[model samples]
Target chain A: MARIIGGLTSSHIPAIGNAIARNLFEDPYWKPFFDGFPPIRAWLDEKQPDVAIVIYNDHGLNFFLDKMPTFAIGAAPEYRNDDEGWGIPTLPSFAGDPRLSWHIIEQLVGEEFDVCSCQEMTVDHGFTVPMQLFWDDWQKKPIRTVPISINTVQHPIPSPARCYKFGQALGRAIASYPSDQKVVILGTGGLSHQLDGQRAGFINKPFDLMCMDKIVSDPELLARYTAHDLVREAGAQGAEFILWLAMRGALQGHVQKLHGNYHVPISNTGAGTMLLENAD
Target chain B: MSTEAITQDIPGTIIFNGEQAMKGYALNKMCYSFNKADSRAAFKRDEEAYMEQFHLNAQQKAAIRARNVLDLLAAGGNIYYLAKFAGIFGLSVQDVGAQQTGMTVEAFKAMLAKQGE
Candidate 1:
């Protein structure tokens, strides 16, 4: 049976893509944010998880308003990235575990999650940025991936508690798979920052700190926040905190916080990065 | 659910719920097309003709014409879609936020930086 090694979280804002492209890590303005990744990369190198499940929100790339799926999973053999109109350089395609994806999909639907499974999906920065952060030169050392997209762009997104439950279902599905593969779950996006309306530059550092702390100790408290409550406290886009909750849910065993870094104003976001190790 | 119940009252924010989605469909569809380089070029060639193709209403057209972020939101524009439109003119979220809040780019950035302290 497959074993879940741990879970990771990173803010997947598009500016991080541009920053990586420009090789701006050492630049003073970017160093604090860029500095967060070395420890994560070192851990990945040591553990070397074979497959990664990325939980992220599609920002108008793969699915638009015409037909938005509340919860979608990628079951393709390979997933590709495309230009999201900011002219950011698109990354190379990522290999997918179709067999494992089908297994998880079957299990999830059986569990009554009713997720949309996609054979073809265009992953945006939300899925790609974290991969870049965790594994530099991902092209040379590739990891098979599965992308789970939650609708955060449009309103009426899934509640935090519901997402946590979905994560728990996902954990069971992965553990039940008949494979020797090791897996890592990545919850990408947000601490707090809004980019719309007159409240565009909103950032709540205190709330963000409370979240990062509680997500490790008491995710139930974080999960208790309604979507509206999250939007009010974490800003509109900051509601992506649910993604982190979903990642947390997948770690059913004893968990420990390995490392964490929080930085402000990364392309109008309160950037957060955390790595949690699981021990059964 | 009642309309008032579904529609949140987050200050300076508009929830892009079903009502806003329905209202902004045409405008958003137009912006979503900007994902393709050729579509962006087509819109650049003739903005008026492009808006016509998307069947954008007067309010949406005016919002696009004015390049006002607040007005665009008032016309039911979701920021994600409007971002593609904003990209045409090389505007980042900071630029839009500055414009909407009536602050210079530096001031808006300063406000964001101060949050960390």
Candidate 2:
């Protein structure tokens, strides 16, 4: 009975948080990034989904080099705002919906997906940055969340095929939920940008556009892409595109682009945003 | 190494080999129960009784039963495996710290300082 309102994909740069906190939206460089996200902002205001299932990769913040999870889902009542070394000027902790999260977990598992469920999980900039951009006064809202933590930081990460399958499982699970509440699936991470070692500051606008095109029309081809392909084209860090596939797959091959935008050189990364509504 | 050799060899290292990895059905079952509304309550009422159904080894069981992050890492578990265990413990690596040393964040910092002494 559950309905997916739509999907939102965005880049999560820590610098964007700094800019927002300092009220530097008018700054020339940051302005383009903010402008690109207007569609997401409008979608959030108009759709107002009951819960947002966010797929993101945590960067050495919640899970470090010591241990990581290829995929972990949050089933907690509330999640505190993390201090990723540098603090977010004045943002409060985010609230979570444990009941709905548990339901989704149960449904997904029933549909035959290997899921890691956590009761007390802290979200890093990957999640908070996107939330800050999409919501108005996110800290104060009663937002329920199902945080899907992807392992993009470490080697031998999930394959594009696997991520897409997980997304399909997620769609099946959400559809199986007995509630009639509306759900929004947000895929946060990248669209061609890399950070780390010599490959830092790589951006492929052609590949980014191609990714957008495939996410909506030719997802089957996207699923066949190996991590090596994404790495070679979009750079290693750009491999976070796997997270976006999960969102695309969840729509079960039904997607309509609401808006799309791309900009580069934001704190040494290419940033982009895309809004998709379920056509099925 | 040539691309073909590297590509073929990669799977053997990460993915479980032989029969160990053939748990697609079991994985699905676990996923289903995990997502259920009464997952926490069900897990709490009879965790051992529930896990017994999995037919995992002592090492696997111990990893899942681990109370913190230290226990998980010390068990020679990978991130995905550790994640399943961490989920059961309701703990994160940030909370548990390194297991072999049993050092808190501050304690670890202190130990580093002692090296300077």
Candidate 3:
């Protein structure tokens, strides 16, 4: 049966995309953030997961406010990136696994977690940036991807608790798939940063640190936070922590944190990265 | 939960709830079109006409004219969509952030850099 090998988390800030495009890894402003990925990349190179389930939030590239789904999953044969009204260069298309996608979608629906399934979806920076970070040369040696976007743009987004449960459902769905395909789950975006209002550049390092630690050892504790609390503590956009929670929920057995890093002021956010392997 | 009851007094933050989404639909719909280069060019060519085509409210238009992030938020603009509107002027999040917080871009960048230290 298909099994989840591990889960990874990273901030999907748009500026990171620009930095990558400009090849600013050694630049002072980007060094710390860029430095977080090499260890995780080494692990990916070793494990070679067949597919990656990327849990990220869309930023107006796919679903808009007109038809926003609280939880949406992409089942396309390929996923592409487009301009997000910003000037970041678009990345190449990602291969998708329809068989696994439909399997998980059916299982999620069967488990009573209604999710909007899309066959044609354009992933934004929130999805693409992390893909680039983890597998910089993904186009040369691509991995099948399944993009699951949670609503972070609109309010009433899924709570940390709800996202955890959804992740648990996802874990079950992946475990049930009748294949030997290895899968990796990526919960992209946020450690704390808000980009609007007077609190536009807000970053809570202590709160982010606490949440990052708890997301590994005691995710249920992080799940206790209401969406409102996340906004208040982590900043409005920092509430993207829900994506990380979903990624954590899918690890079904003894989980070990193989590597982790935390950096601040990555384009006005406390960027975080973690690699947790599941030993079942 | 009621949007106001939940989102009240979150200093310097605006929750993009159903009410705000409904209020800003026309404005946001206009900004969303900026995703396309041609639409962005057209907006740059004649900003008012482009906004008019989307039937933006007086407040939204005024906010757009003022180029004030806070006013745009009050006009029911979500930051993600408003970003497209800001993109037309080549403004980054840090730029709009400085505008909203009344800080110089240098000071704002400094402030962000300080968080790490």
Candidate 4:
């Protein structure tokens, strides 16, 4: 049977993508952020899961204000990287595992998730930054991937409770796929940092730290936080961290928190990364 | 502002919720177009003409002209799309954030550095 081997969560800040594109790992400003990845790379090398179900939100890339899906799954064989204006360096196209994607799509529909299916979609930094940070050779020795785009950019986004439940349902689907495959899920974007308005530069370190702690131990406790509260506390953009709840919910039993890294001011974000192994 | 327009009660931060979406549809659609190099070039070549094509209101045009991040927010600018607009002026997200907070980029960087320490 297919199993979720593990899950990862991180802030997919665009600056991280810029740093990776420019090879700034040794630079002091980016050192702390880059330093966190070696251990993660080692873990992936050790586990070597067959696929990564990347859960990310589009930043005005594919779906626009015209018709935005709260939850969409990529069922394509290959997904393209989008031009998130100002022209961030483009990464190589990602290879997708359509078999696994369709399987999950069937299961999610059976569970009443009502997710949109995207046969063709281009990804933004939210999809690529985490790949660059952890799967450094993703372009060459690329792991097969499935992109699950969530709506965090537009308002009326899915609730934290709903996202968590969706993760739980996803966990069940992954566990029952009836294939001998291992999978890793990524929940990308934010710990705390607002990018707009009078509260710009907002980064509540205490709140971010609390979130990290809760994510490791009692992630469901965070469901109590309304989207309004998340905006108020974690900052506007930082509320995208709700995507982490889906990752947190996907793991079976307890998760062994393997490694975690948190750094501040990575281009208007309190960036964080964590690797969790499902306790089987 | 439309009386029926939706507004979040959050102090200081303008939440880009549904009401703001309706209010800023034209500006955002124009910003979304900035994703293409041709559109970005056209915007740079004739800023006034581009604004007119987007049918931006006086407030949005003034905000775009002044490069005021706060004014853009009040006029319903979503930051993700506006990042493109900011890039035209060589303003990083941090630079725009500093502008919104009424701090110079240096002071803002100092504030961020202090948080890490």
- In order of lDDT, best first, we have 1, 3, 4, 2
Candidate 3, TM-score of its B chain: 0.93
Binned by DockQ into CAPRI classes (incorrect, acceptable, medium, high), candidate 4 is medium
Question: How do the predictions measure up, each by TM-score?
Answer: 0.99, 0.70, 0.98, 0.96
Docking class of 2: incorrect
Off by over 4 Å in 3: B1-3
lDDT of 1 by residue, B1-117 (tens): 887566668898898998889988999999999998999999889999999999999999999999988888888899999999999888988898899889999999999999988
Candidate 4 ranges with C-alpha deviation above 4 Å: B1-7
lDDT values for all models: 0.93, 0.68, 0.92, 0.85
Please report the interface RMSD of model 4 to 1 decimal: 1.4
- Alpha carbon lDDT at A266, candidate 2: 62
| DockQ per candidate, 2 decimals | 0.83, 0.02, 0.81, 0.69
lDDT of prediction 3: 0.92
lDDT, candidate 2, equals 0.68
Highest DockQ against the true fold, candidate: 1
Docking quality band of candidate 3, CAPRI definitions: high
Clashing pairs in 3: none
Cα lDDT tens digits for candidate 3, A65-104: 8899999999999999998887979777899999899999
Ranking by TM-score: 1, 3, 4, 2
Pick the lDDT winner. 1
Q: What part of the reference interface contacts, as a 0 to 1 fraction, does candidate 3 reproduce? A: 0.74
Q: How far in Å is the alpha carbon of B27 misplaced in model 3?
A: 0.9
Error of 1 at B87 (Å): 0.7
- Candidate 2 lDDT by residue in tens digits, B1-117: 964355434211222221222322233233224423355456568777666675545655565565533333333333333433344444433233333335464563343233222
